[model samples]
Target chain A: MVLHIMADALFISVAILTIGSAIVALETRELVYGAIGLAISMMGIAGFFLLLDSPFVAMFQITVYVGAVAVLVIFTVMLVRTQALFSIKEDPRRKTAGIVLLLVFIGGIGAVVLASGLGNPAFTKFNKPAIDVATIGKQMVTYYAPVLVLLGLTLAASVIGALALARREDIEQKNERVD
Target chain B: MATVPEEFRFGNFLASIIWVILIVIVLLTLVILPLTFIVLFYVPLPPVNGEVLTPYLFLTMIVDPTRTLPIVKYLIHTTPFKVIVFPGFVFAAIIAAATIFVERKFLAKMQLRVGPLYAGVWGVGEGILQLAADGLKVISKEILIPSGADKPIFWAAPIAFVATAAAVVALIPVAPGWVVSNTDVGLIAVFAILGFFPLIALLFSWASNSKYPFIGGLRALHQMIAFEIPFILSALSVVILAGSLNLTHIATSQHPFWFILFLPISAFVFFISSLAELERVPFDLPEAESEIVAGWLTETSGMIYGLIQLGSYLKVYALAALFVILFLGGWSGPQIFPHQLGPPDAIPLVKVLTLQGLYNAVTVNAIFWFLVKTIVIIMLMLLPRGISPRIRIDILLHTGWYKLIVLAFVNMFVALALIYAGVLGPGGSLSIH
Candidate 1:
């Protein structure tokens, strides 16, 4: 009973942290602070993964999202050479439209949850064992091989494109005026 | 101020006292009580020795030594013991301190210079207590914050760096079944935790709000990201050779033949990448004191600098432990440990104090070998600090991005070829399992 109650408390706290950080990330004016909020949100998602018994995914999420992705965002923000950021006020009509869209998305999520009967332990207790990393690798290779190959190709192409884009732009010496 | 003191006699003092009392009473009765009740409702009480182990009884358990043995044993398996004591932060910290001392003395001998001659209290013990003296000096100094710095991040970044390092240490296995947070993905968790250091470094630099720190932070980011791919790739070869992602399983798989012999190229790649990731001698451009005034760490003062240094050393211990576990055939050696110390139930005091039954043959031996291998790896890591000069940033990045990746890939292919030829792995003749 104690374990179950503790588990519930853990879940509630993680849920609150995730939502709070997401809101902070969206609402903050400081670009760096917003990036920190995003990192915290990523950590909360990692906690959820731990609760779901997917340790590998949780660790991977932390490494990739909080470690690499958020750092990249912060690096770019810092490169802009500014401390304080000024946000432009949006029109009332745009605000109203955004609120309506958010409400619709929440309503759709609630409807899906009600229809799926999610949270019934018996309903999702088929295997009941943690998926080992070896099986994950095997499944990825055997069943999801094509998608993995496609991702590899896309990544390779992106690297090439980035290199090309970063190459120094050349102009004719005759066309340029000497300072 | 003088007028207030003159006017404010017992009358004003009594009024303030009454107000303080009222506020404390209201806060305790209204806020604390409800919060306590909420916590009690959400978490059930744990039972200890056929009782709920109430707060009042907690003190009683410490006195009755016989009754306390079970509770003590219980606490040993708990998270606190694992996190704070054995195989965790404290253990790693001690190792880190030792490494600092040894690196100084060893490098001194290598250069014919007397290093740390008189550090503490008139130079007793030949400067052996130098790290302690340095630590005390740092503690005594004032931590200065720049006027334009981000106060919150500047204060929090060093602590965050240390916490991240400790978190990584939690995932490493010291001996069989003796880890703090054992999971199926221990190795991956280490990598994930490692990814945080670059972010923390950049955050600290940005918080300082200085031109030099900005340049240092960029160098750190480039260095860290460039090396991470090669680090992952080299580790992948080990995973392929062992056929397991669990660090403990990988260690056990290398019983008779260490993976270093078969995957030397991968080992070489891992070492080079490790040096870069740690920002050691040959790859320490980010914090190059001569060129960039300690790089990103230029603005850190007093205890903050101490904390960052401690965190880096903790990382050194962790990475050394990982290398030991992966390639040095962790905890495996000749069969020398006894199966049992004596006949079962022969001595009651031994059972109660030493917990003899818990001390199995394989566990003790494994711990011994694991420590032996880890120390050797740490020494190897420290050697380059004395031998090599720091390389240029562009050259360091180029080697990390290009050469190391190719070398790691070549080793991976070699591992695959060995597996296909049936030299090792599952169902092969040399399979340990």
Candidate 2:
């Protein structure tokens, strides 16, 4: 009984943290603070994954979202001049559009979730044995090989594309110097 | 040079001490005792020897010699004991402290100097107490924050660094069944925890709001992130061989032959990547004292610097232990520990004192070998600091991305070949039961 209460308390606190940090990420004036807020929100999501007993997913979530994505975001934000980071003017129309989009997203997600029967106690109780990492690896290779390959290709293409763009700028500057 | 206040009185000082003691006593009795009682009432007490131990019984058990052993054994197995005392913070901290002292002495010897000569009695102890003295000095010194700094992040970063390092420590297994957290995804979790260090470094440097720190922080980020790929890939070879991500399992899997012999290239990649990740000499651009004035750590002073050092050393221990577990045959040395400390018919007091109930010869041997291997790895890690010069940032990045990754992949293919050729892995001809 005590354990159950503790788990429930932990879940509620994590949920609150996730929502609060996400709100801060969207609403904060300073871009740096927003990045930090986004990182915190990602951590809270990892906490959710932990509570759901999928620690593998939790660790990957932390590795990808907080470690790579958020770091990149913060690095980019820092690259911009400090004066420009905090000097954004608030636009009413943009704010309204953001709120409407947020509501639509929430409604759409809620509708899909309700329709999918994911809220059923039987589905939520985790009666099935937890899938081990080896099984996941095997499935990734055998069943989801195409999807994995495509994802890798997409990432590689993006990286090459970025390099090409950067190289083009360098060449353009060099050409201008020659001219 | 310094003088006491004219109005300062010995009697007043003694009275103040007494008053403080009185306040502590009053608070303990009034606030702490009640709070403890309230918490105890709510907490479901575990059964001891087939009976639920109440608060009164627990107090009695503390003094009663006959019941004490069971209670002590039970406490030893508890999660809090594992996390805080034996296999967790205290153990890791002790190793980290020893590493610092050893590194100082080792580096000094390499550089032909007597290190820390004045900290111990008549220098007979060879400055064994230097770490203690340094800790005292660091604690006593006031923490200074630069003006216009981000106060919250500046304050929190060092602490977060230590906490994340400790989290990594918690995942490592020193001996069989001796770990704070024995999760199935321990290796991945370790990588996940490590990913936070670069972020913390960048945040701290940014928080300092200084030019040197900014440059250092960016270097740290680039170096750490760049090396992370090779680090992960190298460990992936070990994971493939072991067929399990559990650190303890990985350690135990190398009973026949160590992974280093099979995948020396991966081991090399792992070692180099770890050095980069650790920001040690040759890759210490993040805190290059000569060029960048201590890099990201330029603004850190007193306990802040102390905490960061502690965290980094803790990381050093963790990474060394990981290397031991992955490449070196972790805790797989010859049986040197005896079956029991004394004869079977020894005195009860002797048996109790020697912890016969808790003693396991295999565990002792495992822990002994693990520490020896870990220490050797740590010494190897420290060796480069004495001999090598820091590399340029571009060179470091190039090594991490181009050279190490290819090397790691080479060993990965080697591992795959070994697996397919019936040399390693499950049911392999070479795998001994």
Candidate 3:
């Protein structure tokens, strides 16, 4: 009983941290801080995934979210000139409204949770774990495999199109230089 | 003077311990789940089934149903404690230290010279002793928060990165039934987690607020999107062939013939995609040290740098382990022992252990075979890293979008054709009416 309570508490805490950090990441004035917030938010989401009984998802959340996405945001921040940081606009009214709305939203969620505790709604359990790589492939090929193949073709077309678009510019630049 | 209140200190300390405990639980569960099956099947006289693959059938014979749950349950119950933390941390550190020693020596040998010959044990412990020394060194050194850097992000990044990589091992089955939580979405989970790595490095670079790191981050992001498509799609090929996503089933599916034998191109794509995803060698544009001054990690120091390196190496190992499972028959070895001796799983732990012993053997599994496979892939990656030299960004974009993407499509068709042609299994026959 005590363990379950602690688990629930930890889950709620991590969820709050994740959502709060995400908001901060999205809303912060300083780009660097916002990226940091994004990393924290990603970590929080990873924690939430852990509570969802999918440790793998949590790991992905951390690796891709904190490891990859946050880093990209930070990189973008660096690429833009520091002078731009000064020029960046901040909307105080919108910020205030966002915070107010966010607080109310959180409060409402808390109320709902309190009103109805987490109760297991019995769902048909799988004989084995599902959504593994092989199963996904099986389902894709047997059922949705064509869709995956179509997506692959579309991707190829787009790539070729991009290359062609890029090469045209190169040709135009060369023509200008030669002329 | 420390002005923080006593209660706050206690609370923080408690929280830290709790975090450690939680982490340990997750780790134990992940690492030991597969071993459970291996243990369960360690019992009696082997069966005589001519068609059954000797290793698994042998495993089934020896499987003592009585022993399966105890160890698994025990590990699960006790994992959430500090006791396990020390061992887990040590195991990771020891592997890291061993890799350093092996790499240094190997690099030296590759260059035709003795490496670290003067160190303790005449280079035997070359960097092994240095592992502890380095730990102390990192701890004592000042933690630098560069100008314009977000202090919290800089501090938290390494912890989050290392912790996630460590957590991934729980899903990886070392031996049969030795897993943490055998979730259905294991493959999706791995890919999803792996997808985040370059992004984290990008964040690190961005947090540094440096020029080169910024460029590196941008290149990484572009490469990430470029590579992720082929990587995920190729994995789909394996999934398609197997008709199941659960890793255990995936392994079991390969009992007749390894998936690679049936779909070699898919295997190749998966391997290459893994290399790119790991950001090693040719694909390691994000941290092209000579060009970008260590790219995303320009400003990191001491333990933080160590963590990044460790995480990167582990990623390589993780990828290789996945390859072994998905394509190469994981824990599936040619049977030398007679089947009449015992039941498959009930085969004494030693006999079963001997089959998987190379995989679980500390130096062998952790260093030799693991390192060899990863290094080969890394070498393949290196061939392109600087050997081919850096292409223009447009060229990089072109190759991925045009060449590799098209090749991946062709590869899929080949796989599909092969499957239909009865090359993959007995049932499928390509009939021309």
Candidate 4:
């Protein structure tokens, strides 16, 4: 019982950290600060995944989210023309609407949670053990093979679209010069 | 006689003494943590019987049967026993200082010049003492927080980096079960802790608010992506062959046929990726010391920077051990002495110590091999640092996305085909299972 309580405490602590930092990330005026907060939140999420007994997911979270995405976000933020990003402002009404929508969505989720039974340990007790590399690979190749292909295709399409966008921008610039 | 550090001068003499004592306490914590295992685990076990007892000890007795390794293994397991000896940090500090001096001495000799003969005995001890002197010097030096630097992040980054290194030592299975936390997910934990390194490094770079660190961090992020895919994929191959991600299981799987032979490509990929992970030569482009003054370390100074250096070495040691456990059959060597020397049931303690000893000895023996592997790779890293010119950033990005990514994808397919073709298998079944 004590162990369960401690686990629950740690899980809640991680969730709070993740959500708190994520809010700071989304709401922060400073773009660099947002990236930093996002990285911190991602780290918290990774720790939460560890509690969930999914080390593979935790590693993926660290590698992709914290390591890659955060870095890229910072990189883009650095590249932007404005150095003092904190001084910038967005439309207040749009921000208020976003907050309202978020609260309503969360309220709906809360309502659903209250309506359902959740304290069931049996739901988590599967005979199958933790997912290792082989099982994941086997599943990825055999059952979810099409999804992998789709992801690859999506990546390719995005790259092609980006190239096309750049080409069109170059053409427009040339036309402007000609005019 | 000497003035105390400003941070140390909280109030008066007593407070200064307390501050000094606290630093010593922290140093002791770093050194003595490794030794607790030997005292707690190996000493109290019952003696071994005449029957060679366990398979692990049996194997140790078989491999290198010359020395009574099963008996005297504790002495060599001192890598982890680093905690017990208060002077361990001193030795580390000394060794690091000596490394610089020794390299200089070798260089001077090449140029037909004598090294620092006046400092100590043939300048041998000079390098050893230089580290302490340098420590004293660096500590006294003014710490510069650059104009545009993000103050808190700049200060916290080195601490975070060093903390991750400290955390790794807790999980590294030094000899047998002589580990702080022998979790089932030991291998994954190793990488998880390692993953913190780049984040802190990038943080340090960004916090400095410098152009170089920004570029370094950007390059490091890209390099990490390039190498991490292959690293994890190759690690997955080992997991597939071993049937477990547990370090113990991975080690034990090397019994009949080592995983290296079965999945040579995986081993190659893993080693190269590890080299890249540590941001060492060939892949040490983030620092490319010539191009950028130590990359992310450009602004760092004093003992904090030394801690980062120490952390890097710790990472090196951990990665080497992980490589050994995963590929080079861990602690499963032969016992030197027979149980007839001291009857079966009377010596369970002896047997345990001997096995532990053999485990340590084999690991120590393999440390030489491990060092050889690491050194060769380090030399390879240093070669590019010295010899090769830097590739353009665009070229680096292109190679990562166009070549390495495709190669990793192909390697995954290769791994799958190899698994299907029973390359990582023994006869019919998957070997580890």
TM-score per candidate for chain A alone: 0.85, 0.80, 0.62, 0.76
Clashing pairs in 1: none
lDDT of 4 by residue, B152-223 (tens): 888888777766776665665544555556566777777767766766777788888888877788678777
lDDT of 2 by residue, A57-127 (tens): 99999999999999999999888776755567889999899989989999999999999999888886766
Candidate number with greatest lDDT: 2
Q: iRMS for all predictions?
A: 0.8, 0.6, 4.5, 2.7
Candidate 3 vs candidate 4, TM-score winner: 4
DockQ of 1: 0.72
Residue A5 of model 3 has an lDDT of 100
**Which ten residues in a row are the worst by lDDT in model 1 chain A?**
A170-179
DockQ of each: 0.72, 0.75, 0.33, 0.36
Docking class of 2: medium
Instruction: Give candidate 3 regions above 4 Å deviation.
Output: A1-7, A35-179, B1-93, B122-143, B335-397, B421-433
DockQ (C-alpha) of model 4?
Answer: 0.36
lDDT of each: 0.87, 0.93, 0.64, 0.66
Best to worst by TM-score, what's the order? 2, 1, 4, 3
Give candidate 3's fnat, 2 decimals.
0.68
Better of 2 and 4 by DockQ: 2
Candidate 3 residue lDDT tens string, A1-179: 99879988998899789789877877677777777777777778777777666665576666566656666666667556656556757789988998899899999998897677544344333345423344444677788978999999999999999988777677789999999
| Model 2 lDDT tens row, B44-107 | 8999768898988888877765467778878888999999988899999999999999999999
Which 10 consecutive residues of model 4 chain B have the lowest summed lDDT?
B84-93
- CAPRI docking class of candidate 1: medium
Runs with alpha carbons beyond 4 Å of true place in candidate 4: A83-103, A119-137, A146-149, A163-179, B1-126, B166-172, B179-195, B233-236, B262-274, B282-284, B330-418, B426-433
Ten residues in sequence with the least summed lDDT for candidate 2 chain B:
B348-357
